[model samples]
Target: MRFFIVISSLSKLLKYMYYIYTHSSMVEGKRCMQTNESSKEQKVKVSGLTFAQLKKWVTVDLGMKPYRAQQLFSWIHLKRVISFHQMTDISLSARNRLDRAGEITALESCDTIAADDGTVKYSFALEDSEVIESVLIPDSPRLTACLSTQAGCRCGCTFCQTGRGGFRRNLRTDEIVAQLYGLQSSSNDRITNVVFMGMGEPMDNFPALSDALSIISDDRGICIGARKITVSTVGIPGGIEKLTQLDGQYGLAVSLHSAVESTRLKLVPVAKTLPLRELKRDMKDYISRKGRRITLEYCLIAGINDSLEEASALAEFAGDIECKINLLIYNPVEGAPYRRPDTESVNRFMHYLYPRCQAVMLRRSRGSDIAAACGQLGPGARND
Candidate 1:
C-alpha cells in the first residue's frame, strides 16, 4: 500500500509537469490567433477588453462610430452595468448586436460568511458553476479587496489549503476584475486597495493578471490608483521582470515564508523550481528600476519557519533591497501539519528582526473563523 501510494503521487506529478509544458504553448497560440482575428468575431468577454480594444471592436468589427465605443466602455466599466440593455445611450441595434456577439463575465455570489472582525468571505459561482473565493477586509478608513487570479492554486505550499485542491484553471481578466466590482457593489463601500493574495499565485497567471491590473488602474475604468494595488507571488522571476516593464507604479510582494532554501523548499514545493537566489536577483532589479520598496510576506508557522535563526536569515535577505517585512501568523488549514506560532515565539521572532530589518510588522491573521484568512481559503468550502 505504501508503494502504491508513492506511485500514485509520482504519476500525478508527471501529469502536472506535462500540463505546465503544454499550457505555455497553448497560451502563445491563443494570443497569436487573437491578434490576427477581429475581437468581435471571436466570442470574447466584454469585461476583459480595454477601452482601446472595445473601440476597435466597435468601430472596426461592429461598423459603428468610435464615439460609441467610449459610451459602451463607460456603461460597462464606470457604471458597473452588467447587461447590454442597461446601456441607455447605446442604440438598441448596437446593443442587440453586442448581446449576440459577446458576454460580460460576472460571478454570482453563492455564499457569504462574515467574521466578527468585519472580514467577509465570498464564494462566487462562475458562469460554468465553478466556484472561487475572495475576501473583503475592512480596516477603519480603509477597505481592501482580496481577489483571486485562478480558480485554484498550483503552487503546492504545504501550509496552503488552496493548493491542496490542485489547480483548476486561470481566471479570465474579467473574472479577476469582477471580484472587486462585485465586492464593492455588495458591501456598499469603496475599495481603497486591491490585493492579489487569495486562492492563486498572480504571477502564474501573468497575462490575465496584468490585464486586470491595467483595467482596474485605468482612469477611464475603475480608476483605483496603481499604488493601492498589490500583486503577491511566490517569487517568480519572469513574472517580476514582466511587471517591471509595465507602465505603472504597482506594488510587488514576494511570499518568502523562509529565507533558507532547504526550509523554503520543504514549505513551498514550487521553490525547488525557482531558486531563492534567482528570485532575489530579479526582485533587486525590480526595485532598482521601479525605485519602489517591495514587500516580503513571511508566514510564521510553529516548529517550521518561526525561529530566531530564520528571523536573522530573513533580515539578511532583506539587507540589499528596499523592503518592508510583513510577518503573518500561520492561519491553520484542516489536515495541514503546521500550526500557528505561539505568542511568545511570534514576539521573539519579531524582536530579533527589529534591529536588523528597517521595517517589520507582525500582521494578525484575520477571518480565520470564517476560513478566509491567509492560506485558509479552499479546505472543505462549498463549491456548488
Candidate 2:
C-alpha cells in the first residue's frame, strides 16, 4: 500500500509537470519560469509599489527621500517594469541596490486552460508551495480577471468547492499581483477589469488584498483604475470599514447566498458569527458614504433558495438596503449536495427583485475542462 501511494504521488507530479511544459511560453532564450526563479527572493523595492507593503522599504529602509521614492513609484507602477534593469534613467548603482535588495514576481504559473468561450483559467504555485486559481473572462470589449486571495478558504460555504477544502494560509500581496501580471504577460488581450470573486474571501486576507489593490490601481504602472476593481467579501464588517476609509473609488460585492438566518447559517457557516443584520447595516453606511451602487451576490440553489418565498425575501432584503443584486446559478461541485437553479426559476427570482432593486443574471464562464470554475478549486482526492 505504501508503494502504491508513492507511485500515485509520482504520477500526479509527472502529470502536472507535463501540463507546465505544454503551457509555459519560452521567450528571449529563456523560459518565463526561469526569470521568475531568479527574482523570487529579492527584497522587491517598494518605491513605486502597486500592491503589498513595499512602501516601507522605500520610506523607511531605503533611506531615499520622498520625491525620489515618488519618482521610483511612477516608474514601477506606471511603466510596469519587470526588472530594475528597465529603470533606465536611475543611477546604475541605485538600480543595482534595488535589484539586489528587493524582489517581485511571486506567483509562478504552473498551467493554463483556455476554454472555447475565450475564458482562460490559470493555476499558480505560491512561494510557500501551495496552489491557487484565477480566471480571465473576456466579454468583447471588457475583460475581467477573477483573482484568488488565499490558498484555500475557511469560510466553508456548502456550495463552494474551495470552502470544502478548509482554509489554509492567506496569499502575500505579491502573490495576488503576480496573478494579474501572469495573465497580462501571457495573453494578447489586456484585462480591463478585476474581481476578488475567486478562491478565498478578500476580507479573510485583508492586508495583502488591500496592498495588491493599491498597486493594481496605482497610476504609475499597470494603472488599472480603482473603479474597475471590485473586492468581494463574505460580509466581514471590520474589513468593510477599512475599505470605506480608502480615498479612491472601488466596488464591493457581498456574497449573501441566502436571506433567511437559518438557511444562511447552513449555506455559509460564518453567517452565524457575522450575521446578516450587522452586515446589512455596514453595507448601508458604505453606500451612503460612497454614493456608489453596492452589489449583493446571491447564488441560487435548485429547490433550496429558489422558491417563490425565498425570492420574495431576497427582493425585500435588497429593497431595505437599496442595493443591486447579482444572482449566480449555482455551479455543481463534486460531492456537494446542491443543484443549479433552473432558468425559469432564476428568471422568476430576478422578476421578483427587479422592482425592488437593480437585478441581473450573471452569466458565468464554465471551466470544468480545467477544474478552474467557481467552487472548483482544492486538492482533489487520490484516485484508487
Candidate 3:
C-alpha cells in the first residue's frame, strides 16, 4: 500500500509538471490579452515592428520625429541592442521618451552547444518559460541561422523530434526576429542565410513569419536578402497561397519526405487533408508567380521511405515541376522508431534518383551527434 501511494503521488506530480509546462504560454497569452484589452496606451514592443510601423508608432503615437524610427530600427535590428540606452546617437531625452512609451524585447539564450562539425545549437527561453531552439550551421561564405516559427510544433511528423514534443504556442513576430539577431550576436560570422526549419512549422505561424520575412529582408535593418532565406513547410493548407501573395522572393522548400501519398500520410500526418496533388498544384502556382525554383527535401529513412520504388515515386512527383532535390539521410533521435538507411541502400537510392530529378544533391547530415540535424531539433533535444 505504501509503494502504490508513492507511485501515485509521483504520477500526479509528473502530470502537474506537464500541465504547467504545456499550458503556461497559452495562459500567459490570455492574461496579456485581458490586460491589454482595456489599456490603449500600452507600451509597444519595438523589436518586431517594421520600420514603417515603427515610424508611425513614434511619430503619431509617441509624438517623435520620423527619422528617429530609422535610428531606432537600425539599433534594434542591425546593432542587436536590447535596451534603449544602447542607442548612442539618439538624444538622451528621446531615448528616455522611447523607453517610457515602448520597449525592446529579446529572447533569453538559455543554453548553447557547439557540435564537432561546427554546428552550434542555441536554446532560448520565451516569456512564458517555454523553450525553443535555433541552430547556427557554418557554411564558410554563408553562415546559415535556423530559426523557429513556433515554440513546439503542431505538425506531427513521425520522424521529427520537434513534432513528437507536441504543440506549445505560436511565437510572436518579435520572437521570430529575435532568433536571427540572437544567433548573430553569439557567432563571429554574420548570418548570410536564414532557414525557418528549426522547432515549429513556419506556415502555422504565417502572420508572424510574414512580418519577420519583411523585417529580415528589409534593407533598412538586418537586410539578409530574400533570396538567401528559405522557408520550409510540411504543405499546410493556404500557406503557399499566402506566400505567393507576399512581396519578396524568399526561397521556399517543401519537406516532401515521401512522394507516395500514402507513405507521406503515414510520415507527415498533416498531409492527410492537403494531399500531394494539392501540394503540387500550390508549388506550381508559387513557381509560376514567383519565378523562382522550389527545393524539395527528402529524408531517406531505412525501410520507411527509402527504396527504389520511393525514388521512382519522388522522380515522378518532381517531373512536372522545376525543383532541386535535397536528399537528406535520416538522423538518429532518442526514442524515434526510424533508422538511417545503410550505406548500400543510400547509394542505390541516390543513383536511381540522380538522373530522374531536375537537380539532385545528397545533403550531408550535420550536427547529428549534437541533435542539430534536419528534423532533429526540439526543447528535449537540448543537452541542458
Top lDDT hit: 3
Sequence-dependent TM-score of model 2: 0.82
lDDT of the structure predicted as candidate 2? 0.75
Q: What does candidate 2's lDDT look like per residue over 130-216, in tens digits? A: 888888888879998989999889899998888999989988877788788777877787889999988898988888887888888
lDDT of 1 by residue, 274-318 (tens): 799999988998899988999999999999999888988898999
lDDT (Cα, tens digit) per residue for candidate 3, span 139-257: 88879999999878999999989999999999988989988888888877778999999999999999889989989998988899999999999999999899999999889999999
Q: Give the winner by lDDT: 1 or 2.
A: 1
Segments of candidate 3 deviating more than 4 angstroms: 1-42, 382-384
Ranking by lDDT: 3, 1, 2
Q: On a 0 to 100 scale, what is the lDDT of residue 148 in model 3?
A: 94
Identify the runs in model 1 with alpha carbons over 4 angstroms from their true place.
Answer: 1-42, 381-384
Which scores greater on TM-score, model 2 or model 3? 3
Clashes of 2: 15
